[model samples]
Target: MTIRTTHVGSLPRSQEVVDFIFARERGEDYDADGFDAAMARAVAETVRKQVEAGVDIVSDGETSKISYATYVKDRYTGFGGDSPRNAPADLKLFPSFLKRIADSGGTPQYARPMCIGEVRSKGQGELEKDISNLKTAMAEHGRQRGFMNAASPGVISLFLQNDYYRTREAYLAALADAMKAEYETIVASGLDLQLDCPDLALSRHMLFSELSDAEFVKIAASHVEALNHALSGIPAEKVRIHICWGNYEGPHVCDIPMAQMFDTLMSAKARYVLFETSNPRHGHEWTVFRDRKADIPDDKILVPGVVDTTTNFVEHPELIAQRLSRFAGIVGSDRVIAGSDCGFGTFAGFGAVDPDIAYAKLKAMAEGAAMLS
Candidate 1:
């Protein structure tokens, strides 16, 4: 069987698009019509780039979002006031390295709004625009398979702190209910809905840093339950979930291993599980699948990343093939898809990989998948 290629959403945005995103994020006045035009052009070009590079499934590059999780503030009404920046645990351990990142302008600056009032959808106007843009672009490129990313309720709670809800559970439930519409709308538009849930792994060493691994897994399971509730009637095959230890170049020593949380991650209703496998910190985790192959549900498919995202070096095609083969050896090749460790451009202006090099890596990933096929 032929292997397929895809990526975690959020490719690098053009400068014109970045300017408009920042303006809107700052509440600064800008020509609404102009912003729309820029986004349309950007999405079209991004889709073209992916298709030309041999990605079977593509995305809008998350051009419409500020950052994956923080974009929720625009769609929902309860977020207000800034949430303090919480550095990852591993980064915190090395203050000098963290300072170097700050000095080098590597840290992305954007609003992290707190949930200060009741969570409610403002409407689907922005989401509809995103769908329309992606559909039009895909048609232009003659590409059929695509996925749209939405921040998971737990990730929303993780980044956008809750000030109004009495407990974390209440906050997550409200968010899940509020976000259910967006989740359904994406699938209804015929695009696979990707629930970005870095909260499943990233949060352990950041949000719940003080808790033991077992305790954090319990919290993660609750998060999965909330995600499952939001995913209620959505077809499992139409949905995928992305789990990652934060997407940055860091020590990542504090990250919880996949073995500790694999069962809880599989508990989500999504049929496709996308996660990091290329980065040095987590690349050895193929062993986790080898040991726990029995735990994966029969219907689940694995989208192990064959290329790293937070580095400039474009992975060689043969190396990528080797990476894919490891996962294919554990799960059948029929159940595997090629993907990236995370987004090339997670934020509008922030990414470690250069734009041209990112696409080069994607091209290599495609060649690698072809080798497996």
Candidate 2:
């Protein structure tokens, strides 16, 4: 069987899209029709670019979102005020590096609304628009397979703090119930639903940094339970979960090992698991899978990132092939797919990889997948 290629959702947004998103975030009035038109064009262009780069599967580049985790604020009610920013423990240990990033205007500034009341969906208008835009673009390019990214309930709880819910478990349950509609909607549209669950991994060193690894694993298990509930109605084959440490370029020394949370991650209802394997910090963890092969469900497919997303360096196709081959050797080649470490654009205005170079890397990834095939 041939190897396949895809990427972590967010692609670099054009300046026009960025302006509109920020304006709405700031509560500034903007033309509704004009925003819709802009998003349509952006989605079409992004999908076209992915096809040209030889990617087998693609996304809408998450062009309409400010950021993956925070966009839920716009879709759900009961969120207001700002959540306090929690710096990653690894980044906090190096204040000078953090200062350099901030001084250079690299840190993204966007609204992080808190949960202040009972959670409820505003409507599915925005989600429907996203689905329409992606499907239209994919049709134009003759692409049959694509996935849409949605923020996981756990990640939503991590970014948008709970002020109204009495306890963390209560907050997670509320989130799971509220987000169920969106999860089912995507699957109903005949598209793969990708649950971006950074909270499964990234939160270990950010939100629950003070807890021991065992304690954090228990918390992660609770998160998985909530996620599974949200996915109850959908087929596991129609869903995939993405796990990653923070996307920023920093000392990721504090990231929890995959071994510690592997069991919890597998507990999600998603049959496919997408996670980082290309970045230096977590690159060596492939051995974790090799050592615990018996634990992975037979139905599960592994999408290991074959390209690094944080650097401008365009990895050679041969290096990418080697990375893919390593994972293929552990699991059968049919069980693996090539992906990127995180995302080219995590936030609208904030990204480390250049737009042009990001595409170049994806092109390289496609070439690498071809080598494996």
Candidate 3:
């Protein structure tokens, strides 16, 4: 069997699609139905490209969602108005730099959604187009296997910024229960469910920066509980639990380590674990397999990143192979899947890697994976 390769989620969007999405977010006048049609075409093309690039597994490029987590605001209930994105501690330490970037208008910001009422999915046909478009893309692409990524309950709380729930647990439970429908539908449709869960670590600094480690872990454990409850109906084998530190180019001083969350990650009802093991900050974390080998459940799969997405330089195929080989050496090739450190364009219109380079990186990853198979 070949060593499979896939990305975290969002790939870059076409300029036309980007314009329509940005216009919608800005409350500017745009044709809503037309925008959806354009997005569908984009998704179809993206899936086709993924196949052409030799990706063993593919995604919709998250064409319909604005950002991974914040898109939940429109699809779910209780979200209203805006919440300011509190500066992460790392950025706070570089206020002058942050000010310059903001002044330059180089950064695009999404208004954080506020939780004002109660949380429940609107059953609002949000995923209808997403699911249909992906399924259609599958048939057209002659897909091997694919996973559709969605924000986990914890990540929704992390990005949307809660304002109304009496306690964090209450908010998490409501969010989890509300998100259960999305999770169930994907699995029932025979697509792998990848739960984007940066809250387990990245949010410890980005969202809950003020909390102590012990305090932060209390929240993390609660997130795990809510996630398991959300996954109650789906078989673990079909689930992919994706966690990571912030994907941006940051100092990362405040980010938590992988060793800290291994137990909680292993406890999740997921057979595949996807996370960063290529970027400089967390790259060394591949050692976690060696340090905790016996602790990992035998059935679990490790989708360690073999390519770094935050940079524009295309990784040499041999370098990519080396990264994949490391993980395979430890976990055995059968359990290793090559992946990017994180999504190429994690947020809408917020691509760091050049669009063309992103596909090159993916192609290189596929070639690298072939080395092992």
lDDT of 2 by residue, 1-373 (tens): 6799999899999999999999999899999999999999999999999999998889999999999999999999999999999989998999999899889998899999899999899999999999999999999998999999998989999999999999989999999999999999999998899999889889998999889999999999999999999999799999989999989889999999999979988888987789898889999999999999999999888998888889999999999999888878978999898999888989998899999999999999999989987
Q: lDDT (0-100) at residue 110 of candidate 2?
A: 91
Using lDDT, rank the candidates from best to worst: 1, 2, 3
Candidate order by TM-score, decreasing, is 1, 2, 3
The sequence of per-residue lDDT tens digits that candidate 1 reaches over residues 1-373 is: 7799999998999999999999998899999999999999999999999999999999999998999999999989999999988899999999999999999998899999899999999999999999999999999999999999999999999999999999999999999999999999999999999999999999998889999999999999999999999999999999999999999999999999999989998889999999999999999999999899998888999999989998899999999999999889888899999999999989988889999999999999999999987
lDDT of 3: 0.86
Overall lDDT per candidate, in order of appearance: 0.94, 0.92, 0.86
Model 3 C-alpha RMSD vs. true structure (Å) is: 1.5
| lDDT-best of 2 and 3 | 2
Candidate 1, lDDT over the whole model: 0.94
Displacement of the residue 330 alpha carbon in candidate 1, Å: 1.6
Candidate 1 off by > 4 Å: none
